[model samples]
Target: MIYTLERTQFFTCGLDEAWAFFTNPNNLATITPDTLNFKVLDTFDTPEIYEGMIINYHVTPLLGIRLSWQTRITEVVPRASFIDNQEKGPYTLWQHTHEFFAEDGGVRVKDTVRYAMPFGVLGTLVHKLIVKNKLREIFDYRQQTLEKILNYPAHD
Candidate 1:
């Protein structure tokens, strides 16, 4: 079964600034948790994001076991939103959508991730035992890091 996770954050920045910051692949490591050891393996030739862009990364998400993850930028809307689908990764399915909106005080950033595990019933068991909480922890760290870097107020 596929599982979903959604996170929303408000940044004290404009849509364009938020878009540029989020679209830059280099900034990923800055926001990601240190424990994950996430690294992007792409030399961005252009500053603007375009569809079909492929990003490769090495991440140690669990038990110090490093894995290669490849994702393709499937859709892009400047200053609005983008979607990335996993090409190869630990999960059986991974699709992440990032959206930006102009809110009262700043830009509202939203992320929606849909993923499924491998190994059928075993995957379900693992999800319950570990993956679910791990995902939450990852996003929680992201939110905290983003707030610090962006100088935005923290959420409860």
Candidate 2:
């Protein structure tokens, strides 16, 4: 079964500023929950995100069990939006789209994720028992962290 999750957040920042921070793959670790221990395998010196870009990372999503995930940037539109599809990951299918809009003197960032687990019926049961809540926790952490990161004086 395929599942979807969407979250939106507004920050008092310009479009360019929000675009730069969100597009940079390096910043992903900062917004992710510490318990997940998300780490990128490759170092990205440039903040420019482009189509065909591949990111490799490992994350401890549940029970301290580390899973390596690889995603490809399939679409990008500068400060507007980008879509990434999982090449290799825990999910049977994982596709996430990050979108940004300039609204009310701030940037409204939204994320839409469509994913599916493995193991057929067992996967559905597992998602009900674990994955759903875990995803919520992860996104909640991201929202709270971004609220802090995007509004502070240190934000650049």
Please give the lDDT score for candidate 1: 0.91
Residue-level lDDT tens digits of model 2 in 1-156: 899999999988788899999889999899898999899999876777799999999999888899999999999998899999999999999999999999976889999999999999999999999999999999999999989878646445
Please give the distance, in angstroms, between residue 136's alpha carbon in candidate 2 and its true position after superposition.
Answer: 0.3
Q: After superposition, how far is residue 131 of candidate 2 from its true place, in Å?
A: 0.4
Candidate achieving the largest lDDT: 2
Clashes of each: 0, 0
Candidate 2 has an lDDT of: 0.92
Distance from true position, residue 79, model 2, in Å?
A: 1.0
- lDDT at position 17, candidate 2: 90
| Clashing residue pairs, backbone N/CA/C < 3 A, model 1 | none
Q: Which one wins on TM-score?
A: 2
